[model samples]
Target chain A: MTPAVAFQKTSRHFGAVRAVDAVDLEIKPGEFFAMLGPSGSGKTTCLRLIAGFEQPTSGSISIFGERAEGVPPYRRNVNTVFQDYALFPHLNVLDNVAYGLMVKGVGKDERHRAAEDALKLVQLPGYGGRKPSQLSGGQRQRVALARALVNKPKVLLLDEPLGALDLKLRESMQEELKQLQKALGITFVFVTHDQGEALSMADRVAVFNDGRIMQVGAPEEIYQRPASRFVADFVGSSNVLPPDFVQRYAGQHRWGSLRPEQIRVRSDTSGDGVAARVVSRHYLGAATKLSLDANGLRLHATLPSGTAVPEDGAHVMLTFNRDQLHLMEEQA
Target chain B: MRSDRSQSAPTGLKIAAAAGLAFLHLPILLIFVYAFTTEEKSYQWPPPGFTTQWFAVTWGRADVWQALGLSVQVAAISTGIALVLGTLCAAAVSQTRFFGREAISLLVILPIALPGIITGIALRSAFSLAEIPFSFWTIVLGHATFCVVVVYNNAVARFRRTSGSLIEASMDLGADGFQTFRHVILPNIGTALLAGGMLAFALSFDEVIVTTFTAGQQQTLPIWMLEELVRPRQRPVTNVVAMVVVLATLLPILAAYYLTREGDQIAGAGK
Candidate 1:
């Protein structure tokens, strides 16, 4: 089947600022695709262009295989859950959810039934009667979700849908939203500035920077094999070895990225590996992540809770297979 | 406001405020006092006797009834015209910007900023220059000039406070431009428009100077009051008319204040 959403060399400019410079990508149907970046990275702009909130100054976007050029957002098949939810203040939740159906001239009885079904899908079955102001942030987000999902568009765009929630609530909603997507089987194009959010929830992520896609792949592929220093620096926290390491064995060191768990903490007694000392240790519940000074380089090692941890001054050997190490070419 | 002044109001200031309150209501109080006073035979502080008969006579006056009807007519027509023109102008100016948005804004504010006499004279001259016969319609036109400012003021201010995101949300959900305007923009602005309409009605009802200049043969309440004040036949009835005008204008303002007191929340990202 054709992809749920596609952007073809899309470029959008605002005066002197290039909000979304020439970008090309695809979001597969039923895939939770995330556009991850920091603020001013043009991720939201890309989502808006796909949702038809804005037209590309150049290139084109298509939803479900059809060109969406010059199509106003109202005429488009996709729906958006805006950052602030944007619920109608004058209306109750039922009215807000039913708004799309009402505008489409769906009869009262059928629209109400659909709104209730949507509300139940978001687990807010009785919340249809309450105004948005009466609900908490999480509830409001769920309402925004139900409102969008009710339209049954080919793609559902979420622009920082959980950015407004508390950290705990945000984490919980990430799983909830992921589960919701799986159950509904609708394409989700989620835009978020939070790297953790993109990683934890999305099936595939397109990491963006300065109006360009730096890398795009499955979560593990992008995390384990960042294409550049920017991607490695953006995703999972990784320590950069000296420039000489990437320059000297540039091809052999093609293992461009490493997870903290992958590094084997070998004993210093009989080791040929580069030597490092423990600098700091944080004992998280299940594991301990140790920050180390490996000679002149900074490295991170996450050890299982039962592993023998070295003291601050104790010498230790670190052994890692070639696959654990990643070589990233410098981007100009 | 000065740093030298005490943070709490002094005793002297409190007494002065009490006196100011009394002073503002003093004339209105005297109107009712003189309405029942037998000293109505002559303008005097102390009336010889109090009689409630003038209230009955004032109620029965044909001229007062005619003026009341005319005032209602003028107020209705003026407010009706203002609601459409001011709403359209507010809607037009609020949305689009051409060459002179600021200049148009200044023009909307101009009529209310000038003294009523200037506006009255300008309308009279414009009518004469154009050779349009002065009638009830001319008075309606004159009242509408300033009335537009009242409605436009409320409507535009409320429109600015409404979230642009709500409209965008409506559109993104499948409503077209007109439907979004009707379902989202219109409901959001309904209170403001209602408030503006009330204010325009109040302003147009008691408008004297402009009505005087514009009403050639027809008589509105304000013009009739001016005539009664000059001729001096039924002074007590003038007090009754004043009371009616006070209630007519005050109720809507109070209602508007009550209506906009709630829904003061700020939501949406791109407001």
Candidate 2:
């Protein structure tokens, strides 16, 4: 099956800053693919390239397998819900939603009907006449979402669409956006700086840094088998120990990552695990996250609530299952 | 927060503002008040009597009619020219970065910022140097030099405040260059253009100094009023015409105020 979008050594620069490096990837059709990175990782730049708001400086970008180098943003067969929810402040909700259809010369009555349909799909019905400023933040977001969806694009790009919402509202919108994507069966390319957002919402997450996609995989794969030290530290916290390749589980001097939730607490012992002492304990609901100081290295381990809780500054053994750890070649 | 500050003005400041408003408008109110007084030219502290006979007489005179018609024609023509030249200049200066962007901005706004006497004298000398005899067209051109600045100020501020995203959004949605500007940019700046046009027309309507310099052997309303003030033949007409000018100028100012009410919203530049 043809990928919905593809980049072939695409590069873009703003002045002297390499906003997007020469990178290659293929986004499968109907996949909720997220470019996951911290601020300035070129995730948003890639979305802009796909949306035709920007052109790759020296490489190729293909949308639906067609060369999109010269295509302007308006002519692109994709739409974006901007981070700030760039709703037209002058127009009321109904007119803002009907904008694309109206611009395409659709009749007033039909465009309004279709706009109403899109509004209902976002679970907001009959809010058509209220101005954007008059609506709450969530309502404005839904209106912006409706504005993009009204055009019926094959690929919907979201530029941190939920970044502006409060914590509880953001969670609900994330689930709703995911459900909407599935229901529409449209390809989605979401750009975000929050790792948790990418982990939770996307089927495939592409980890990026310094303008390059370091690794791309399912959220589980990225979390469990990060390919590099940067990915290990970026996806979740990690504790690195010098490898004992010969004596321990074969080829063990390579840096390894441990998930915070992947470790177990045991009695005051030092065998069947990396020998360590608990330096600090943070009590969280249903679990207590502990930081261990193991022979000059700091390690993170999360233990489920049980009688196995260890006192702070107590010497204890921490064991990670051998197979759960992947050796990463530490860069010199 | 700033809105709250304005709302919480002290009583002293509030009274001062009111006094300033009266200082500016009380003379105009006096002109309107005496427009109906039977006392012709002499200052009657309070009117001895009031009559509408002067209004009837002012309405019937051919010279008054011609002068009124001339002022209307000049204001209309000057406004049209200002709308075109000002919008184009504003768009050019705003959209493109050039070697002389600052100089161009200064040139565009200098007419409005400079004293009217400066503009009048400069235009007069320029006309003499060009050997162009003064006429209605020359008057329109002179008036438009300043009027265009008004239009340019309004339109450019609106253009700058309009998010480049809207234009990009339009282009990305498949609109060609002209269609993008016509549908997206035009609607966004529509009120600014209307406001600018109304303001330009008002400024041109009561303009006297510039007209005096360029109105060769012609009788516009302000010039006619000046002549009537100096050589009082049928001079109660001046007071009536003053009332007419007061109303005509006020109407456009009101319309412009209405049009520009949301300009602050549309003109939100990146602060």
Candidate 3:
């Protein structure tokens, strides 16, 4: 099948700044894809390019086999749920959701019914009569989602849709959004800077940095086997052991990544492990994070909550499972 | 602590505020009082006596009626032109960027910023040079020059405050340009436009300096009132007309104030 969205060597430049540079991406139909990066990493720009809000400076973009570069957003069969809900304040919830159908010349009664159904899909039933101003942030977010979903576009682009919500609400919304995408079976292109959000929610994730895609793969692959130093450092905060460190520890001269949780720390200075001094300790409720110095090479290790944490400035035995040290390709 | 500080202003500041209010409103109160004065020729202490006959006299004057009609017509047409031109200008300046965009915005606001007499003299000379006859349209053109600024000021502020994502969301939801404008942009800026139009009407209705230069054969109410003030047949009659002018201008200004009082509450603001 043709990809739901494809970019051929896309590059969006603003004067001297390369907002999105030489990007070649293809998102499959019905896939929950995420473009993950820090701010200004071109993730949002790529989403906008798919939505036709921003045309590539030098590229050809296609949406489901249709040329999309010059196509206006209104003509594209893709809708966006903006970061700011962007609900029309003047319109009540029903009208805001029904707006797409109304503009498409759907009959008022039919559009109303469809809007009510869309509202129900977002679990906001009976909120039709209230204006957007009257709703809470989460409710408004749902209304925005309903507004976009009511259009029934083949692809949906969400720009950091959960950034403003509280942690609890954001977690719940993530689950709801994942379920919604599965039920609707529409291609979802989610942009976010939060790696946990990306890993937990996306089927396939693209890690972006400096206007370039560092790596793209399944969530487990991104977490377990990052392709580069940037991905390893950005995705899961893994302890990136240098080539020298790897050569000394694992008998190889390749850069390797060891997840913090995979590193075991024992308070006793015992045999069969590298001795390290605990520089600092932090209690994180579920785990204790320790900054360790193993002969001047700094590393981090997370000990689960039940594990006895050593006193600060104490020497400890640190051991890493041989299989857990994943090698990366890039030198930098 | 905050409520105590807010509720109890210093006594000196209170007196000063009362005095300032009195200073501003005493002149207006005098205008209202003199409208009912019996004296028809000259100023007097305590207005000599009060009467309602001047209102009837002012009502019967054909010149007053003609001037009122001209003023209303000019104000209405000017406000209509300002609403369209000013809104378009505001949209262009606020929504998009181009070379000299700031210069164009400054140019749009220049007429209202410059001294009125300078604008009046410049308009008079431009009209004569262009050989455009001074007619009802000339007065409207002159009024619209400044009236556009009023509408532009309000509309541009509102346009800046309104989130651009609303327009993007509209388009994302399958709305074309016009539909996005009508459904999203217009509703967000509607009150600002109405308030601007109201203020434009109020400004155009009582415009005197520009009208004096532009209205060669026409007499807008203010010009009529100006002439009546200089050479009076029944002085109280002019004050009665002044009272009407005050009310005419006051109602719309008040309405504009109330309409824009909650301007910060535009949807999606701070979202």
Candidate 4:
């Protein structure tokens, strides 16, 4: 089957700024894919390129095997759920949801019925009569999702759809969106700055930085074996050991990543481990995060809640399982 | 704390607000008071006596009717032309980026910013240079020059406030350009346009300086009233017509105010 969306060396530039630079991407049909990056990293620009709101400066795009570059968004068989929801304030919930069908010349009764069904899919039944302003932020988000889903497009582009919601609502909506993508089996292209959201929700994740794809892989692979220093630093909090530190520990002069949780702190200094001094300690509910100085290099360790942690300014031995230390391919 | 501060406004501030309102409205109240005065020839400290007969006399005057008719026609046509041209200009300025876009926006608003006499003299000379005779249409053309500024100001502000994502979302949902405008953009800016149109109508109706230069042989209500003031036949009648002008202009302005006061409530605003 043809890929849901493909970009061939797509680049979008605004004057001197390279918003998206030579990005070649393929989103598989029926896969939950995420373009994850920080702000100004071109993730949202990539989503807009797929939606045809933007034309690439020097590339070609195809959607479901059809040429999409320069094709107007109205003619594309795709829909977008904007970060702001963008629900029409003038229309009630039903009309807003049914807008796509109505524009396609669906009859009023049929379109309204379809809108109701879409609302039900988002678990917002009987909310068809309320104006968008009357609904809370989460409800508005659901309405935006319903509006996009009502069109039943082959590809759905979401630009930080849960970004405006509070943390609890965001978590719940993430689960709902994941389940919805599975049930619908449509290609979902989600763009977000939150790495945890991307890792937990996307089947395959593409990490973007400075207008380029840093790495793309399964979420587990991305977490377990980041390919670059940027990915290791951005994806999660990891103690990026220098090549000299790695050479001292594992006899390899390669940059390595050791997760904070993987570092074990021994109170007694009688061990064949790196001698370190605890510089500071933070008591989390279920864990204690320690900032340590080992041979003038700063490293962090997360000790489990039940472990007895030494006070700040105390010397300790820091040990890690040899297999838990992952080497990075990038020099810096 | 907010309620406490709001409830205890300073007495000096309260007196100042009342005095400000009285200063603004006392002249208008004087116009209303003199409209009922029986005196016809000269100014008086107070009304000699109140009478309802001048209203009957003012209603029967054909010249008054003719001036009122010309004023209404000029205002209506000028507002219609301003609405179309002003909205188009606003859309161009607010929705697109090009070289000299800011300059174009400044040119659109320049008529209202310059002194009215300068605009009038400029328009009068331009009309004469073009060999266009001053007629009722000339008055409308003059009124529309300033009226467009009113509508354009309101429309451009509203267009800026409306989120661009709404338009993008409309297109993403499969709406063509016209459909997006009709279903999304229009609704978002509908009240603003209405308010702008009303204000344009109000401005065009009472325009004196521009109309004086443009209307060579025409007598809109204000021009007629000006002539009547110079050579008095019934001073109270001019006052009655002034009352009529005040009501005509005041209603639309009040409506415009109420329409736009809640403008920030537009959908997806601040999102």
Candidate 5:
């Protein structure tokens, strides 16, 4: 079977700034894929490219095995849930969700029925007559989802659909979206800058930076063994050891990194591990994060809140299993 | 909610507000009072007697009916033309960007910004130079220059306030360009256009300076009233027509104001 969406050296440049650099990515069918990066990292641009909103400036993009060159967004068999929801202000909930079918000349009754079903899918039944302004932020977000998914496109492109929601709402919506994607079994390409959002929901993730994909792998693979220094630092908190330290301890050539949680902390002060001083401690409800100074190198570690860690500014020893260390090539 | 501020205001402010309302409306009230005055030839401070005979006399005049008919026709046609041209110009300026966009916007508004006499002289000379005959169409064409600006002002403001994402979302949901315009853009701007068209009609109905230049031999109601004022025959008759003009123009202006007052509360507006 053909890949859901493919970018063959696709690049889009606005004037001198390359928003999406030469990117080649293949998203598999029925996969819940995520494009993860910070702001200005070309993740949204890549999603726009697949939705046919921004045409590639150089190479070509293919959707569902067909060249999507010059195909307008309306003609493409894809839908986008815009970051701001972008629901039609002039329309009622039912009309907004039924807009796609209405444009395709579907009968009013048929489109209304389908829209109601879609609303139910998003668990927003009986919200058909209300205007978008009448709905709350999370409700509007779901209405946006219903509007996009009512058409049953081959792929659903979500552009940070949860960016406008509060934290608790975002978490619940994330679970609902993951479950919805599984139930629909369509290629779901979600774009977000929140690493937790990307990690907790996506089956596979493509990490992007500076208009380029730094790494693409399963969530565990990306979290465990990143391909580059940027990926290792961006995906989660990591204590990236300096090159001189790696040369002294690991080898002369390898670059080493370890997750903060993997670093073990003790106050015995006589163990076979690096000696460190606890400079600061942040007491989170479930876990405590500590900033440690290990032989003049600053490092971060997370420990369970109940752990009997050393007091602030107290001397301690930090250790980690050698197998937990990740190595990467030195970037030029 | 601000009762303290109102209570703190001096009595002089309340007197001044009452004076302001009287100053603005006293002449119109005088016009109405004289429309019923028994005297026909000269001004009177307080009429000796009130009568309804002048109303019938003014109703029987054939010339007044002709001019009133002509004025209504011209206002209607001019408003129609203004609606189309004004909406199109507004859409082009508000929805797209290009070189000289600001210049074009300024040009669109120049006719309304410049003094009416200047616009009248410009249109009169242009018509004469182009050898177009002065007719009903000439009067409509003259009124349209400023009428278009009125409509354009209201429409451009509305078009700018409406979010562009609505149109993009329409197209994203499989709407063609025309479909998107019909479903999204038109509904958003519809009330604005209606309010604009009403204001344009009100202005066009009582237009005199431009009509003086463009009407040639044709007589709109204001031009007829001007002739009646100059000739000074049965002055009460002219007062009756003035009352009619006031009501005719006032209705549309009042309607337009109400239409736009609630326009800010658009349905489904984003928070």
Candidate 6:
């Protein structure tokens, strides 16, 4: 099947600022894909382009193998859940949810019934009469979700939909969104800057930076084998081996990275790897992450709670198999 | 604690507040008093006895009726023009960005900022230079200048307070431009526009400075009142007409104030 959406060398510029630069990508149907980056990284711009709020300055975009050029947002077969929820203050919850169908000239009774069912889908069954001002931040977010989903579009675009929620609510909403995607079998392209959110909820993650895609892959693949130094530091915490060490061991053409957990911390000095002394140790319930100073080079080691962890200032050896170090080609 | 707070108001402050209220309202009180006075020609205070005859006399004047009708017509037409132009101006200034946007905003508010006499003189010269004769429409055009400013003032504030995302959401939810305006933007600004329209009507009804330059031979209510004051006709009858103008303009202003008091709590305002 053709992908749900595709961007062909799409670029959008706001005067001197290149908001999205030469991006080529595709989103498959019924998949939960995430665009992950920091603010000003063009993630939200890409989402806007897909939603048809913005047109590309150059190149083209297509929805389900058809060109979407010059199409107004209302005519598009996608809906967006804005970052601020953007629920119409003038409409009650039910009317807000039913707005799409109303615009399409659906009968009031049928649209109201569908809207009520959509509200129930987002767990806001009895909230039809309340104004948006009466709801909490989380409830408003759910209403925004219901408003978008009620349209039953071919794809749903969410721009940091949970950024305003508290940690507990954000976590639960993430799960709810994942389940909703699965149940509806609709393509979901969510944009967020929170790395953990992308890692935990998405089947595939596209890491963006400086208006360009740095890498795109499954969560584990992107985390374990980052395409560039930026992704290594951004997607998750990782210790980058010094350039000299990488040249000496992995050859000069590649950079080496080792996950914190991949480094073994032994209290004794008998090890095949480099010798180090523990500088600090953090007790993280099921594991202990120790910061080690190995011959003036720093390394982080995460030991499972079952292993013996070295005390601060204790002499130890750090060991990792050569195969555990991941390498990436040097960028030109 | 409440008693102590109430007592804390100094005697001097109390007298000052009372004096301010009296200074503003004493003339209006005098107008009401003289309207009921039996003395028809001369100003005698202590010998005056109150009667209801002047109201009947004022009601029987055909000039006063024509003047009142003309004033209402001018005010109504001017307010209608202001509502459409002012709303369009406010929406453009608040909702979109382009070159000279700030300049356009300043121009929209300039008519009210300038002294009424200056606007009056400028309008008189422009109408003459363009060879347009002063008539009912000229007076309406003059009133609409300031009335547009009043409506624009209320409308732009409300528009800025309203969320831009609401419009985007409407479009994303399959609403075209007209549908989004009808379903989302209109409701948000409805109360504000009503309040603005009422205020514009009241201001146009009481307007004299601009009307003086624009009314060629027609006498609106204010011009009629001015002429009546100039000549010593049944002075009590003039007072009765003044009382009607006060109530006619006062009610809309008060209604506008109440309407706008609750407008700030717009459903999703600031959110």
lDDT of 1 by residue, A158-263 (tens): 9999989999999889999999899889999999988888988899999999999999988888788788878887887865554555444344433255678888
- Candidate 6 CAPRI-style tier: high
Q: What is the C-alpha DockQ of each candidate? A: 0.72, 0.38, 0.81, 0.80, 0.69, 0.83
Worst 10 residues of 3 chain A by lDDT: A266-275
Worst 10 residues of 4 chain B by lDDT: B262-271
Distance from true location, Cα of B35 in model 2, Å: 3.5
By DockQ, the candidates rank as 6, 3, 4, 1, 5, 2
Worst 10 residues of 6 chain B by lDDT: B262-271
Q: For residues B1-271, what per-residue lDDT tens digits would candidate 6 score against the true structure?
A: 4466545678899999999999999989888888988888775785369899888888898999999999999999999999999999999999999999999999988888888899899999999999999999999999999889878888898999899988999999989999998988999988888888888888888889999998899999888888887676688888898887788678876777777886452111110
Between the candidate structures 1 and 6, which one is better when assessed by DockQ? 6
lDDT of 3 at B139: 90
lDDT of each: 0.83, 0.83, 0.90, 0.90, 0.89, 0.89
Model with the higher TM-score, candidate 3 or 4: 3
Better candidate number, 2 or 6, judged by DockQ: 6
lDDT, candidate 1, equals 0.83
Error of 3 at A74 (Å): 0.7
- For model 6, the stretches where C-alpha displacement exceeds 4 angstroms are A267-272, A275-283, A291-298, A306-316, B1-8, B263-271
Which has the greatest TM-score?
A: 6
Lowest lDDT 10-residue stretch of candidate 4 chain A: A244-253
**Considering only N, C-alpha and C atoms within 3 Å, which residue pairs clash in candidate 4?**
none
Q: Considering just chain B, what TM-score does every model have?
A: 0.88, 0.88, 0.92, 0.91, 0.92, 0.92
Q: For candidate 3, give the lDDT of residue A253.
A: 92
TM-score of each: 0.85, 0.85, 0.93, 0.91, 0.92, 0.94
True contacts kept of each: 0.87, 0.33, 0.96, 0.89, 0.73, 0.96
Cα lDDT of model 3 by residue, B63-95, tens digit:
999999988999999999999999999999999
> Top DockQ: which candidate number?
6
